[model samples]
Target: MRRATTVKFKYRPHPKQLQAHRAQVDELLYGGAAGGGKSMFARAEAILLCLRVPGVRVLILRKTFKQMESSVLPKLLEEIPEELAKFHASRYEFTFKNGSVIQLGYLDKDGDLENYQGPEYQLVIFEEASQFPENHYSYLESRLRASGEVAERMEALGLFPRRILTANPTGIGLMWLKRRFVDPYPPEKVWRPKPSEEDPEPGTRVYIPARATDNPSLNKDYLKTLNRLPEDLRRALRDGDWSVLDGVRFSSWRENKHVLKPELFPISLLSGRKVIAVDYGHEAPFAAVWLCKLGNGLIIQYREAYAKGLTPVQQAELIRDLSKDEEEASGEPIEVVADPAMWSRQDAGAHKTKDGSPPVGSQAHAYQTVLNRRPIKANNSRIPGWALLDEKLRIREDGEPRFLVYNTCRDTIRTLPTLPRSKTNPEDLDTSAEDHLADAIRYGVMHLEGKFSNLDGLDDYVDTMDPMETYRIAQAEF
Candidate 1:
């Protein structure tokens, strides 16, 4: 490596920024909204540090290679004048006259960290640190080393190498970083906390608020672009506030427009060819509801739910009662579907009735026994179930909602929309919240859509004849 020569460009730092640059702080976080000279500050600090220490090497990291090429790379070239631009572009590096060098790199993924393991740096910079996973930061920390001559000099002063991070507050690691740096001390002493019970780890982490007002030199065109953004996005960008992105999922939902007076749904839809779907839960309330489509319309009329958590036998009794109500009122064909997992030969446990019958059967014989006596069946697959429900909720050409909810099924109605995405996976939301009713509805739709069976003449025969008669006729034909 070639020795870097010392060079300095005059800079006028504000009181707060000057304090940030001069401090003996080990870890520094200059963060917040756009137009905050945070990025410029970070780059200037790196340049100043190299000037301070001869032959010093600095590593400036961004979240991705594209980011390095786009923001960091272009900004560095633009800020450093032609006289100092003698830096090596091919190596993604800059060399100062004093022998100090600055390298620009990106940590795009976990694997990217390994490339930096052996390289030693007197200073490290993480731009947009919030975009990275916590583990990536943790992994990089282990590689923080000031070896040989740098270590000897630092050892004498009792100061280790330092890191600077800048980012707007948003990401999966937001909670961890907030707890550690933003506020290490708890507000209430009585509220005992875990992780580090005492003071935070003896690591340096600082958070500085930066806004458009902090950077007066912002380009007028850029400011105009920021002004043109939509209200929420403009607020988030200009004020560094966190808000939800819309039009992807649950964007059209409005509480006032969707919520209506609570009451029982009409019986005409429920009485004719009904499907009862159930999602069983022991801790929370067990949910089972009656639903049927209105003609070919997407309106979903949910008749009722089997009220509370009950033993398996009691749930069975409840199902029988609801079945009788449907038979008497609508006299329409009825079918029931539940989670297939529930049909596994598992212990009914304390869910047994006074007669000692388990809510679920532990033996295959028991499942068969339930089949012989009840009007219920367990759905074997959920993907198909969800597809059925999705198909029925299609947005019509007229532009109304694809599905309508009757006021009667309040529990299902309230919960179907609030489910949050799974922390581990972004593709699917955690179905835990109002998932019971949703799953039950999914199964009910699947059962109605004839997805459960692929028999050639099954739908034609069922539409014309009773299932009992069709069963006898099929058996006779075989």
Candidate 2:
């Protein structure tokens, strides 16, 4: 056996780090704004755990291999003293003389979970956990089991298995992470999971929110850099507000301005032209939004149906049922505008229809067959559609937004505010988020804009120039 070498390092953890280290929980989320020293805190905890427990195994994971190589691995090397462990470059791990091993791992794609199939670790840390989907995070939790020998050693040392996740409040996984970690408790409070069917051995889960102010060691320039971010991004990163997200396409979406009380917009007043905008998805969410043009030219989204795992026929049935009463009262067919992708019949395999004949090869065809009306294909241009929606969402000089959503349209109201900006096209919305409702809204708004002229009576309340054109001009000036 190799002789144990003396390990020496000094780490003065701030209050947030101290809270994280002292958390006695099965899962702990040390997350919040940028410059919170989350990465350094995770490294220190992994090192201290390995030093105290012999024959222990720790797995530290980032979302991508490039991140593991560039950010995580270099930090581990700098923090762990030379005398403590031997670096095995090939394996991307550090093996200490006391038999504890620290593995630096990456899980970028779905298939990357295969690399950690049988390894058991006493502690597993997910750096930037919000960057990964919930399925990837769930699969990783199964690998947190310990071997019998490791368990015995842990029992002797009075230490239990733990999974630590550190992240900022922006990513594709933000919604689920917020529901899991942040939503469970008030800020800075420790939360314990109650026993449930899914979680039989309900373990303590704590969330410790830290901000840029929590770490005095952060450079002033870095704080300034964070502050210099866009308004939504600055709030999410600097203030760690989960309700807001970075790169939001509809920055003007305020609950007070855009969302209306159900009683405020009576359905009786929605007697004008009505439309149903559908964004079809079987694996992902299928969104159908019911919108109507009020006489005042303000668009109200009064009803919606958003769900997943339903066949096109079932979706059509649900949509018909949702609009049944409204259609009956109006005695007129509600126009349907759907995603252009639904109109494609190419390569769509066959299925049995209700009458036992071959099914229509496309979603649009199926909906048309069921509803007895061919739906209008929406203008799917990304930038123009998004711009139209942005125009509707913007509060004009008279303090009235063109678009208003009823509180009963919960999914529409919930998802519209959180849609992030697309990286590929800065002007478009991110499709990875739960953006089906937003897509449906875009389709409805664009179709309405194409069919109807601008509201006639707005001259008294606002300027003659189009608000959207003014917005574009302001953007150009900036």
lDDT of each: 0.60, 0.81
Q: List the residue pairs that clash in candidate 2.
A: none
Candidate 2 per-residue C-alpha lDDT over 426-447 given as tens digits, one digit per residue, 9 for 90 to 100: 6767788789998898888878
Report model 1's TM-score to 2 decimal places.
Answer: 0.50
For model 2, what is the alpha-carbon lDDT of residue 277?
93
Best by TM-score: 2
TM-score of each: 0.50, 0.67
TM-score, model 2 to reference: 0.67
Candidate No. with top lDDT = 2
